[model samples]
Target: MSDDRFEVVIVGAGPAGAAAALALAREGVEVLVLERGDFPGAKNLFGGILYTSVVNELIPEFWENAPIERHIVNRRWLTLDEDTQIGLDLKSAKFDVPPFNNTFTALRSKWDRWFAEQAEEAGAMVICETNVEELIVEGGTVKGVRTGRDDGDVEADVVILAEGANAMLAERAGFRPQMGPRNRVNAVKEVIALPPEIIEDRFHLEGRQGMALEYFGGAVKGTVGSGFIYTNHDSLSVGVGCLIEEYLRLNMAPYDMLDEFKAHPMIAPLLRGGETVEYATKMIPEDSYDSLSDLYEDGLLLIGDCAGLVNPSIHHEGTNLAMASGVAAAEAVLSARKSNDFSKARLAEYRERLEDSWVMKDLKRYRDTVHFLLENREMVNEYPDLAIRLIRRYFTLDDTPKDDVIKELWKTIRSEVNFLKAARQMWRARKTML
Candidate 1:
């Protein structure tokens, strides 16, 4: 075995690790990325949507060369109440043109491997099938990592921990918190294959154009969770997720929740002929500013999910944050290398870079969002039901008088969440919404 040491060691070859590796390697620095999966994205899943602007900033006009499935021309946010759905849909023809504005949905199984290859091409040595077990520290500073692979103690000037939700290695170095039930969401997503034409027609998309729909309310049964459907080339990515703590309290099994979500009349008709292709469940980190541990400790910095960079309410909005954090980490590493200061104080600049980006600003904005949902679960579950019942009544076209319908609306609202609780919830939601 050869004694090969890199300037930086990154664990987990996901979007964050790959982005950091590509950025650093392009600067002519030795970067090593280690992954436990046989290949990148092998164990990853999401209702995967990749916003191209971020990717283009890392690799210009990346869509032209990237293995993307389709352009997203339509997006819908659906708030559901059993069989009823109220949604906001957005579509633009310009979104399909050069340098697409919105993102496209893709299967991570294919996209992640290709993304990692870009880092490899840029000269970052990515080693997959290697499990990083612990961080190597010396004189109160991280120096490298110890992997589970035989004869796998690799040394580096700095180690960036990008290992997803199980950010144990980073926590060992005191870079993050111990995983708490409320701070994470257990998500299960499945890919269901429909014919390409059917998908296009169902989602109302043009040639290779796709749509994304986010579900609320009944999906997670009032928890601060969601169900989603995103269009791929010939398939629909569908799933539901909720806080692990809430699931425990509600005694909700994820699969049971998924079953209820898919059976909704609105979703069922759309996925009529599709066949389930893949089944996967993983924990998603929901905490942000409060969840972030020591991002920079001595000669190491943590990026991506390891830094607890996810916004819970939005549903797996971590990839963009991860890439941004990785970019910041890479820039900081390059600066430290040039100045020859691998000290903890020198690497703290990475924190400033993150604070200036949306990664930190947005997280700070929703810092109290998770607990808000925990406190007021009825807004998501019961309110939607009340709203739907009112809509159904207003549009029933019965023999009842028109004025009576208006009176019914008030009666239903009072019956279902009660005015006082609704007012308190509206106030709480508004606090962190803006």
Candidate 2:
């Protein structure tokens, strides 16, 4: 074999690539990982929730040594109007225990670099600051990858692409179609720094326990998106994201939307005196299960965001699914190596494994959610405002009698809502969202 050749060459060192490398290295496979960033996670961004069930399967009790910010004990779902907020709040002592409901918050820059180090410790060679330009194809099969550096062609029996949402390499290689604006979401986040005590007091957290709050409706100015605030140890990860198509329709910028979200009367008090420590923006692949790209080709596989593995439902799960796909890819590669066949047929096992796991099942179940929400813009734009007004009227002290108050509320509902249309929308939500 040439000096640059390996048993497997994996691109990008995010959760998916790192998990693949770790699993392969543990089995004594000669694997090389190429990372474009100065290090893994340097350019990665997410909404700050890390569902750790997949991580536990990869490295048992990972939170003990991982760079985790906090274990979430409180989860709140809020809907906002211009001046009012109302929703459900659930806080449980059950989530404060070990395993912590498999939920935690982490900064990707710290988490990704640390995860790649685990692969390195397991004997995988991870090279950073090297950009993979394209796949080296021969006779209709992938042979390796061509990097930007001189003599940068690296050979492998098989290659895995964990490149993120932009997926230039996947597009160039004809592995997938170009993602449309409807299939993409542009997210912006800022890590706001504050004293640990202040953070705990503000968010009602104790010790390493944390809170995750999700905002909808007027949070994004009634756009088809959501806002989030996750409590880290001494910082808050505050962000908002929406469909790129919505941004174009509204003729608005993401940063400007973020500023408006921060200035909201209901949102400002929580972040009254914080310093911005880090800000980032990235595009997330939100393709539905029906539109997901093909997972494998001749001697090649795609995982993570490159495969459009994000579950864009209310759960907002991506990292866990990405890591799960990585492990499946590694298992498929190991099985293929035993037979010394790295053909497209052999890599079919990767897709089969994903289909058998929760990764694909959850995605398939929520296949219609994004489209359903998009079609019913009133769900975000009008419903929340209507709900808040009704709740506020119910709570306000007035001179009207109880019977009169009930009559007034019914009148308002009748005037503002079409009962038949609402019933149909609610029934559709039961199938698509619930």
Candidate 3:
């Protein structure tokens, strides 16, 4: 209730932090969100599309007010070679219409600012341009946060860490391990401006409907990473990302890989003459289930990417998990407040809540996926070329027998990768991903 104290303090104003601030403030809890950026979203970026169900639970029909570009109606998965690509494009009319769909493309800088405003409207005090220097702890319990400004020690009954993927303050407070030591993927994205009509025509869309495309194989220059392209209202988000180890091994810059991806035969045509207006680089935590940081301690909790809550499955769903964990953290904080107990044992309920929510369940289900896929990098590099070769042969309309073509395709696949190794990897994928 005072300038120097609040019932709950959240660091970082990304999705998770904002979600927590909104939920707590709506319930009349004194919550303070500290954002290091000049504004809430000045430093935030995402591939594109926000899974809005969790957020909608907080703000019903949020799309009507949020700065959304388009609602996704099509999903494309492409396997590419140097000069060729094979893809599956799925589109549905069901996604074009109230409750249109759960996903929408948004510019984070715009979306996050609006989201923080929502929190502010609900009575949360959000202070931007303030970097938390350290957590004030007493007797191993978090008491408040220390910032750079004079007399900047602000007190709080509980501190929630939603400070994005880098989690510097959490690491400094010894709440989690250094993010640099964990498995991280470096990604770079650029927003290319295009005409709205051109975007709709090129992607086969109509009236605010959008498409999301993901690329494998040559996208990462055959490294253990992937690339993505998403259609905004009048722009395209194109980026490439790879594991830190792969980046070092390949000696490739994330932006350089993105440039190469943009120029690919199958990709270049899509962005023929678009002008790029925005660029961002981010670090995604690929070690979701295995290397999750400590989630809670006395009077403190961690949520979102700070806790390594990313789902490293094929979907790469991070924002949904972030919002879900934020809600769970807020609920736990409310419970602790009701009991007037902010000890470690009381805060442990946050983990229990996540375990019961889809955030932990989904992460647990695909826990082995990242490791499995990383170990099988050949699937990203060799198999796409093999697939292209087989597809080319299959539809060549030659005078050869269909059975003979099948035999040749099988032979070609075996020659590129050891049959046993491929089979083993396939089996592991089935066991882990399917």
Backbone clash tally for model 2? 0
Best by lDDT: 2
lDDT for predicted candidate 2 compared with the true structure: 0.92
Q: What's model 2's TM-score?
A: 0.98
* Tens digit of per-residue lDDT, candidate 2, span 211-295: 9999999999887789999999889999999999989999999999999999999989999799999999989888889987678
- Write candidate 1's Cα lDDT for 234-337 as tens digits: 88889988889978998979999999888988888988989999888878888757767758988888888778988665534778888888999999999999
How would the candidate models be sorted by TM-score, starting from the highest? 2, 3, 1
For 77-99, candidate 3 gives per-residue lDDT tens digits of: 88888887888888999988756
Best by TM-score: 2
TM-scores, each model vs. reference: 0.96, 0.98, 0.96
What lDDT does model 1 reach? 0.83
Superposing all C-alpha atoms, what RMSD in Å does each candidate have to the true structure? 1.6, 1.2, 1.6
Q: List lDDT for all candidates, in order.
A: 0.83, 0.92, 0.87
